[model samples]
Target: METSVLLIEPDPTAAQEITEILQEGGFLPVTRQSFEAVHDSVTDEMPPKAILIGTDNVKESVLSFISELKADPSTQWIPLFILSRTNEDSFRIDCFNAGADEFFLKPIHPKELLARLRGWVNRIGNFEESAFRDPLTKAYNRRYFDLHILLELQKAQKNDYPISVAFIDADKFKSINDNYGHHVGDLVLQGLSKILREKTRTSDLVARYGGEEFVILFPKASGDQAANRIQTILEYVRENPVAEYEGQLRHITFSCGVAEWKPGLSVTEWVKLADDGVYEAKGQGRNRVILSNLQTSEHDHLEEKKKVLIVAGKGMSKSIVCEIDSLAYEIQEWQQGIEEVPPEICIYVIPPTKGFDAGEYEQFRMKHLPKECKTLLLTENHKALDSFQIMATGIDGYLRGPYLPGDIELGLRRLTNLN
Candidate 1:
């Protein structure tokens, strides 16, 4: 399929030159002589997938034009590239700061320009295939839910955080489709999706799970806590009616089943537990939320209470002990100056101290560390070490500062799947 590009060049000669190259490259290129006329010329039916702005001058008006394009809600999300003859540092910086996905110098190499432009358009198309939204309801689809569920599981395992999942099904939905047309059924779904989006916390994720069902992931919430929130949604659905069909207002209620995520639990198992909860909710009645009765066996508790050793200088080691003590693990303290590492400890924490060197620690670890173990290091700051230096050491992770949350946590979670 030919990708459409909106090319804006103040100079007619340059616009005509680029237009021919785009046509030869099999792109449907629309040329405009003025940036001010861009929005008006491109109507909703024929909106370009991306826009390219080219000019030799780097004036405030040029920068303002980019800013104005960004400010206009219709043009904001569309990819925009800036092409100019001026390659000054300030000019490039201002263009990107305003909003330019790609910047190129003038005297365009037609092949290079087309390759780069097509690359961005193709990438956006691939991403849209795996896009988060469910077209019918405007909620996230199961793709987004599955991706986040696994991520949240890894985080819960690493950081000892609580997470919950709920499976929600609209009661007697097929009857609604049978009585009223599928059109009304779609409206019912859209209405329910809006209610779920508005009612849930921003931290929570709600997704459409095929027909008549939806799923939600509640990070940092237990099953009971998830149940509490679902109760309110249940009440709201009861109070509200969906659509007016045949002079009668149609109403719908949902049944929800909630389960908490646990350490050592696989994503499939976690989802199964939630599905089981839905089964119970359906068995009990159609319009209720039920929390699954799950017991943490002695084996599970023992796993959660796994021992973690901290190896560092006295000051830093003790500080790490304090931080990790907040978690479920049993803390074992070891002075970094010690000759040997304890064999039994599988997980280790090494918080930063002044004058510590990662290069030297790489050598020390080879000699004394156990063959199979997890090591988490804390550097001076975010920029204390480059990613290659951090990665070269082959540690499991870096510690997140108590104040600056999420950076290390998210980075480490991503690193786990690289294997």
Candidate 2:
């Protein structure tokens, strides 16, 4: 694609010279003689890749134009250059502070100007490519998805256009790793990702949302449309298995959660609802699509009410505390050096003392205890047990060392009755 430049200079002679220089140097320069004209041109015409403002005699107006462009999010990312005849240090600082991407002097050499403009254009192109394109699947990444989805959602909310989000995850992904090794697992993901890319619409955004999970942002799509599209992709994968790995056929399946964009909800909230639907699909079966109903009670109410407190110990007890607190509970960490216990569910890390002091322990408990609170004590050495026993008057649970994810999950499940 040919690079385009917007040259904002009121001086007719300077504008003519710059336009000639840019045209000779392979840039399509669009010149504007006035500040208001430059603003109108940017809004009406196709946006240029870069903008150059002559700040020699009209520094204030040039600065104002740059500021206006920077303030508008749509034009802010375009590279901006400032040309000035003033002191290099002061002018450069002023330009940079006002968000200019580059600065040049008034007596511009054609070659140098072309080189800098080309460099800026190349750099901006590379940046945009990197920002939008996924490294693995060569599809759009989450950053692009987020930005595009936000814009689509706004249009949908304002003008009644349709938008939907689909949360996708590879089924039995861990089993893939365990069976064929990680290399083959990666190959499976890449293969599935390629198939997904081929299946999706050109206008739709398909992005990897970490690990085996992917998300698709569909503009002008209804919930039924999104579901049908996703189901077709899933069916295609099941029918055509990847057979290139070790002469073994690998059947890849996916689960999807779909949700439509609604007004008055942030993008994060909309996505979380979609994620909940994905979990529902996984719970029902491996390969299925679940559409989320905003009014449904399937969403966990406990998650809204649960609060967790995490405490750290010098030894294995820190892990133990974290594990015990993970059971069916929402938790936050207690800041170190805070004398007061902030929450009702408190997890205290018991340090091993040489001699257990019952009076001191009782005083400590009395100081930190809140009425009707559940306390979990974590200990590393058995010697700390004596102190815990002394301090165990109000304690609800005690955990020892060497905990695993399963153990923590199981313990929390039992503790919170969330089996």
Top TM-score prediction, candidate number: 2
Predicted candidate 1, C-alpha RMSD? 14.4
lDDT tens string, model 2, 1-419?
56788998877888899899999988898887666656545533257888888875566666656766764444667888886767668667777766698888777888888898888788877987887787766767766665556445544664577788999999999998997798888787778778878898776778888788889888789888998899888889889984368788788888999998654344556788899998999999868999886764544342443455655433333334323331334556665476543455655665533333456646755666566666666554566665446455756666663222333334444445654
lDDT of 2 at 314: 30
Q: Which residue segments of model 1 deviate by more than 4 Å? A: 1-130, 297-419
lDDT of 1 by residue, 1-419 (tens): 67789998988899999999999988999888776657655433357878988865547878877765654433555778888989789988878876688888888889998898888888876775457689899888876675556545544554566889999999999998998889899989998998998999887888998998999988878888999999999998999886666677878998888988765554555677788888888898779998875676733533244355656555445434433332334667655466543433323333322433677777767766676656666654454566676688787666533322223323333434411
Model 1 clash pairs are none
lDDT score of residue 195 within candidate 2: 85
| Runs in model 2 lying further than 4 Å from the true structure | 1-49, 53-61, 71-75, 83-93, 104-110, 124-134, 139-160, 198-203, 239-243, 246-249, 296-419
Q: How high is the CA lDDT of each candidate model?
A: 0.71, 0.69
**TM per candidate:** 0.45, 0.55
Candidate 2, poorest ten consecutive residues by summed lDDT: 319-328
**lDDT score for candidate 1 against the true structure:** 0.71
TM-score of 2: 0.55
